[model samples]
Target: MNQELSESLDKSCKDLYKEETKYFDYIKKIKETAPNLKNYKTNKSKKIDQAFESILSYHEEAREVIQRKIRYANEGLKTTNLLIKKYVQQELISKLPGWEGSSNPPPLCGKIPANNNYIASNGDLVAASIPDENTGSAIILCHVKTYSKTTQEYKLVDFFEDLNKGPSYYTLPKEDVIPIPRTLSSKHLSQTEFSKNEKVLAVYPETTTFYPAIVLESPGSRTKKGFDTFYYSLRFVNDFVEQIEVYARFVIPNNEK
Candidate 1:
């Protein structure tokens, strides 16, 4: 179903492009014909009048075709968005802890949402306010999994350090945790701005999790929201010779004092 919707969207886009091309061609004809009839001195008056009529006809026809194509394109876009949203919600439900599938489970993958004042479901990554290091006045990334819904409590932290005992979940309230931002979902949890040679944590060739890394070059993007919307080259901290290009969204701050 998703594939069919995607193909429909592609065809709709192509049709819109064809309509736009036709509109441009009509405009080009008007421009070419108008310049040739300068003051009607060299050209016959009947010819000039006929040329004006042709230009007006082309303009009206282009407007009609373009408007019709735009309406069709909008309907296609709306259907595509609705289907995609449905699939995403279904996938999110499958990723929740203790979720069981009918025959096959939906694939679980996506960026964890950022902080917001609401109840986060199980499988969410969040930030727990802890004292400096142990929770006096510090913070760390955690994963949310409901151990007891009646008490409004959860087990946070689903990751582990390298060579550790693997990931585990600890207990905390939904109120104590802030859902981490998607920008920080796969990042090192540092400040937003990263300069050249600045220290950072980045996901590997992919975004499973963040590892210690350093920025290697200038950030690049179309707009002014640098780290929030840029790409940077980075080198991992533990490894010596494995540099990778990462989107700014995947680059994050290391939990430093």
Candidate 2:
């Protein structure tokens, strides 16, 4: 509704400006044809100026209203994210291997595993922040292909993808790897259920195949444009930030291929 209203207001402003121009042209004719009524043109111009000022003021107020709505929406989003973080820390990751209700919790504060024992095992899904010239450094979702305890390095493969694919292999440091829970379900990571920077496979527009992406805004309607559509504001692994909006249905948890 806000989008439609904004467009309509803009159209009206243009139409009014066109008519205002025509009015000045009409009065200019009177000035040219009769020199005695110069005061009339001056008074008419003042009235037009007043009307234009009112229109300008109206535009400013409308802009302020939109900005206020944006501020409110952002505040709500911040609160929602805080709640998701708390829930994930309590429910999701808390159930992972090393976090078996132990006194010493897993390394979640910085998201790096403290040691080999704290890290996930082979075939466990993880979000690896590996970057290459092509992928542009966004976190790509993958499953642990292998890990070297001595080197503290992990070999990750794109989640459920073919192992023969050369690009699918991701070698990440212990610090860049985030282990995902083996029991985490699709429902826990869907839309508003997703946490900030959560690993995901979102469908690229006009394609059925899900690709690697990270969550920027979960259940996000591309809110930058004041939209409330069913879209996940995502950044595909290949690009830094571009026109990427995957429908909610197309966005799924990292475990799914």
Candidate 3:
């Protein structure tokens, strides 16, 4: 039985190697094709740009898929090694009592179970600050997913509120406020998640002293697609300030299960 299992494991490893080699060859072909595609002249710059963008996007997605496959293969190799050492050898298996197998935590942030649905709905929150001379203001930007058939474009909401809740609440009328439309470039479209870039605005609004933070939420449709939500908080403070802190929480429907 042990010998059969070892042979099976060896075959799996060989199959994985072949798959890896195929993926590497595909990547090389993509790299070789990129320069030729770039040199092709077209009358319409917009059409050319769009075509190039699609190619890049396909390349990126394919790369991610290949990487995930490689990761799975490596994990399988580790599991096979532990199984052989324990069951086949028998020496190590007798010494350790109640040892099921060698356990490994998740790749990111330890063994915390991630909420994929939330990530799909609310894109991601990113914050940054702009400081010039004696004056500077913090910005909190939320990238809300509006990619469904019902919705047209992504929405970014900026808030000027205290990081720590106080009695005073900053309020601005919707009509009075004007939000600058942020253009999406090819680089921005490639990312599965959203991240805001810091910019120094000409006019700083008058508001109470407050740290900045952002909350990202995906659309309801995206949650149904099984993508975990991502949330991030950032605080910008002057060099003189002592403590800077932020916290975030999310609620999802059908969360009882």
Candidate 4:
């Protein structure tokens, strides 16, 4: 069990520290690039600034938040190590010979193996996005499980609300959609057609899929090269709650498509 505790501690802290590094990198990137865009004549530049403002506004605040999380995770690791040592030295040593005689069973005592190759009901950790009902797109942790005798499905909790309160559910195969709504016209709608709160189909990054989303902001228009373009901020339709920045060509009107 000490090994398991150690492994879990390492996994949790490793991820937290990784995230802390990412936050610092993000802050650094913002500092390095955001100010340089001040003189640019594009509305997209303003959008970039606005997009990072909330994060950049309180650099100290962001640092404090990330530092607090790192500190908490470190403290947790220390506590886990102390507890593991206390149990082994103070209690388990005397009871190991007569293991069945203890009134309370020791948790994690030879119950979970330290070998990482063993696949539990949940498979390896994977990066995934889920369809969100309330917020559009939601990022979630999932365990890949055999949905049937042959098919594999991800066992995940709903990303919204209290995830621990509900029964476990599996991701369906059909949810991995390439949303090609055939209702749309061949010519894309202009940026002027998109309005705030309008439901539209927009492209998800790095996927051929288009997701239903709501337009959060249409931050005016800008002319580039010989043509005009518009930038939009969108929140996805289902479990994906992450806000995305999209060009006008990517934001399809609900009436047309």
TM-score of each: 0.32, 0.31, 0.23, 0.26
All candidates in order of lDDT, best leading: 2, 1, 4, 3
Provide the lowest-lDDT 10-residue window in model 4.
177-186
lDDT (10s digit) by residue, model 4, range 1-257: 24455467668766766776688678769667766665665767767667677666566575577678767767876665455434422331233331232233332122111223222244332223566798786444343543332453435432211122233554655233111211211122332335668887665543323467888765342222323234467888774556776544345544435
- What is candidate 1's local distance difference test score? 0.53
Cα shift from native, residue 52, model 2 (Å):
0.9
Model 1 C-alpha lDDT per residue in residues 1-257, reported as the tens digit of each score: 24455467668767876776777676667656765665745547668667667776776776677677767767876665555444433443344442122232222211223435456666665555544444355344455666566887777664321112234556776666655334221222223346667776564552234567887753532123345324567888777676676655445556554
- What CA RMSD would you report for each candidate? 19.5, 17.6, 27.6, 27.8
Q: What lDDT would each prediction earn against the true structure?
A: 0.53, 0.55, 0.33, 0.47
- 170 Cα displacement, candidate 2 (Å): 8.3
Model 2, which residues run further than 4 Å from truth? 1-43, 93-119, 122-152, 155-171, 174-257
Better of 1 and 4 by TM-score: 1
lDDT of 2 by residue, 168-229 (tens): 68777887776543422222223133556788766565332357788777543244466544
Once model 2 is optimally superposed onto the true structure by TM-score, how far is the C-alpha of residue 251 displaced, in angstroms?
A: 32
lDDT, candidate 3, 1-257, per-residue tens: 23455457567666766676676666557655655686455576557567666766676676677667667756875665455323422331133222122333221111122333222233332222323255553333333323333333333333221111111222222222222222111111212222332211211112212233221322122234543222222223232433221211211111111
